[model samples]
Target: MKSFLYPNIHPPSFTWINAEKTQIEKVHEWIKPITNKSNPVECKTAEIIVLGVPLSRSSISVSGASEFPEAFRRSWRSFTTYNLEDDIDLSSMEILDAGDVPMHVTDIRKCHQNIIQASTALYNHFPASTICAIGGDHSITAMMVKGMHRAYPVKKIGILQFDTHFDLRDLSDNGPSNGTPMRNLIESGDVNGTDMYNIGLHGFFNSQDLKNYADEKGVHYFTLRQMRKAGVRETVHQCLEELSSKVDVIYLTVDMDVLDIAYAPGVPASTPGGMTTEELLEGVLEAGKHPSVMSMDIVCLDPLKDAHAQPTVKLGTHVFLTFLTGVMLRKV
Candidate 1:
């Protein structure tokens, strides 16, 4: 195994109390007690740090997704869940909102470096705790992967990308963008392309060349059609089995575009036949069952595009809760 690199970067300095200035303060209050200095006698403290990397115009129009972290925080205050039947308790989990990473709005490269720096800082303090990153765009996923590799230094890391698009676009005339996160990670050699698995791929947008490239790289491509044929339970089981054997750690990345446009209209990209929100929840729940999952990210939320902010924040909150539930369940 390669030795882990501990970067001296640090999370932006801000108090959680300042969240009260935004609509997400209510959500902060809800999870604050559990994440407060007083709770969690046995459970590992979350430190629930929130790092917002709102990088817009990254070779794609989904640039509006940069507002997701703040939007999610503001919207989570009103969000509620009664999925106790599924073994989830929002009250028991410790979640801290660490705030967003500071970045130069006009500079994509600088923004990317800022994301890596902030994420590396948080990883230093909470190497074993969950770090929930809100999206500026999908490009941030590459840096998150970088930070995880620097911290864990595993020989093999499995990347589970749930999205409507393959995000396999190579570096272009404008450089890397949200659509090229996976490709960037692979190109940078931070993650083995062969160990990657992309789920929820749908639509007619993909070409034969893209499919062949993914296959040639040994990236496991699981289409929605195949998953439907195998059934969610069996498909998820098989994915876990394969990933667990091939990698020491797993990173779960969710792009909201994977959900149907009707279910998630707030994303930069939308596909009509995408997975339903319930299906997404179930898939995440199942993925979380795998003990090897090391970190997770929920990206591509555009509050501006969402009507009344109904599903954008709601969906984001649910994903966050589902991720927490998955992490907790894995501990058992």
Candidate 2:
């Protein structure tokens, strides 16, 4: 049992939406919480489990990304369980909040180990549940996948990442930064590049070396331009088709920087040229509709950089809602 896991033991706070005397039940009100236990969790009730990893020491750039998971939980108050686009009531769905994996800010290695241990323990206990995570930074993903592989050694996992960068930077010189997770996973033989599909890559954010490395590894990538040209739904379906068919399960990771800087100012590395909010939502919804998608993590959020309106934070929460709505559709 890892001593680093902290379940949401505190009492719930009043939602911002409710302060307005609204009759609608917001997402935070609908979400169910489960305290972390050292023993294997009983898997009879949950359909999805949400884990928080507050880590950022390994980011390639300076950021307050460690504040993201908490920020996301708070942001949950702003959304309703209803999805107008899908005509699905998320109340029909089930989400088990697994609280957070306490991060060791000064020790990236230790923090990663906590993520791996917590992920492996929880996943093994609830093997049938879909795992979802709100991250401190992108680095936690490599560790999470490592745990996934450990929990189910026989399963071949596919990755579907929505990001601006390839995140394939070699860790030889710098060791396990946010920019090196994908490469680290591939190098470790935990995830195959051929089973990975990276979407929303654009701008001058990436390098030729990284592109060459990705190509050499056989990573399938589709740029924002390609999404626009091919249509978001079409491209996503094609990617999901290939991934779901070839791998036993799919892991979806969304780097908030994949959105345009104008819309996602809270993301540490967001740039001018990126996917529109709608494009990203639509893209992830496609992934959620597929039964093979076993896990997802929304990362790179830096709440300190957010505007007073808190658009970025709220948008990130909306991404989860839309995806869950897709899951609801499939369940019905």
Candidate 3:
């Protein structure tokens, strides 16, 4: 019986996203729990606490994505707390930053367990709060989903994934990587296959076996071509309508590689043609509006591989903020 490790890493303070020093407060200025501190600032009032898991060892192909959490936090200033689309300001929103889970534990199994245990604690402590786990890779998705289920075992959990690949492959010789999270989740019965809704799956990035598995297990999915024909809004509407009827909760996960390579060249599994940033953002916003969506994550923004301007990180931050905007609207 190996207990997970917890390291002492001080969480970074939120830098105000608002640069103009407007009367409206910025998201960066929001207070968060200091890492490893027993007495974190009063976060019970927070509706959401964002946690980072910078473990990339499970990624089958690319690895440097462990850098996304810090990079995303650094890019927070580029966004505004004001939600232009929903016409809402989040200055009044109580947000807590719980800092990153230490990645020093070299054993991938221990790392995975650490994520589950930490996430479970966060969710249990803040039962009313949505835990947004920033990923080191898609593998973290499995851990977070499990943690959420552990916290609320009575409810049926659903998954809404926006990505180019199905990520349904079984474990390889190296064990569970980013490619296996969905498979692991379904197999573990944490989420019923039919309750999992995936959008924007496309290209040669996936294989027939994985696609077959998705269909065989009754996973609801819309291909990128289908989404394009039906429109992003319509596709998302369909996803929400179907999943909402079947499950008590929805967990939204977005892999940045879902965006076209032009938009998100920094991702570990980026492809040439995929959803536009606006489409992905729209999907996220729509997903957030659902009452059933309890937690969310955005993964695969590798700063180490980013372009000079850090376009992926910038867009990723926008999506993150915009999702919060949707959550604010939900409160209204």
Tell me which of candidates 2 and 3 scores higher on lDDT.
2
Best by lDDT: 2
Local accuracy by lDDT, each model: 0.71, 0.82, 0.80
Q: Enumerate residue pairs that collide in model 2.
A: none
Clash total of candidate 1 = 6
- lDDT of each residue in 22-121, candidate 1, tens digit only: 3332444655422223333333467354555666667387457766766776665565533565755554556655556667758878878877877776
Model 1: pairs clashing at backbone N, Cα or C within 3 Å: 23-74, 24-73, 24-74, 48-96, 50-98, 52-100
- Candidate 2's residue-wise lDDT over 1-332, tens digit each? 22223331221222223343344367777665553342334534678877777888888788788887777778777777777766777765666666678666487798888889888876876788888888788998999999999999999999999999999998897588899989999999999999999999998999999999999999999998988999999998999999988999999999999999988999889799898898999998988899898899999998889999888888988888877877777867
Q: Which stretches of candidate 2 lie over 4 Å from their true place?
A: 1-24, 36-43
| Rank ordering of all candidates by TM-score, starting from the highest | 2, 3, 1
Error of 1 at 141 (Å): 0.5
Q: TM per model?
A: 0.85, 0.91, 0.91
What C-alpha lDDT, on a 0 to 100 scale, does residue 20 get in candidate 1?
A: 46
CA-only RMSD, every prediction = 5.5, 3.5, 3.7
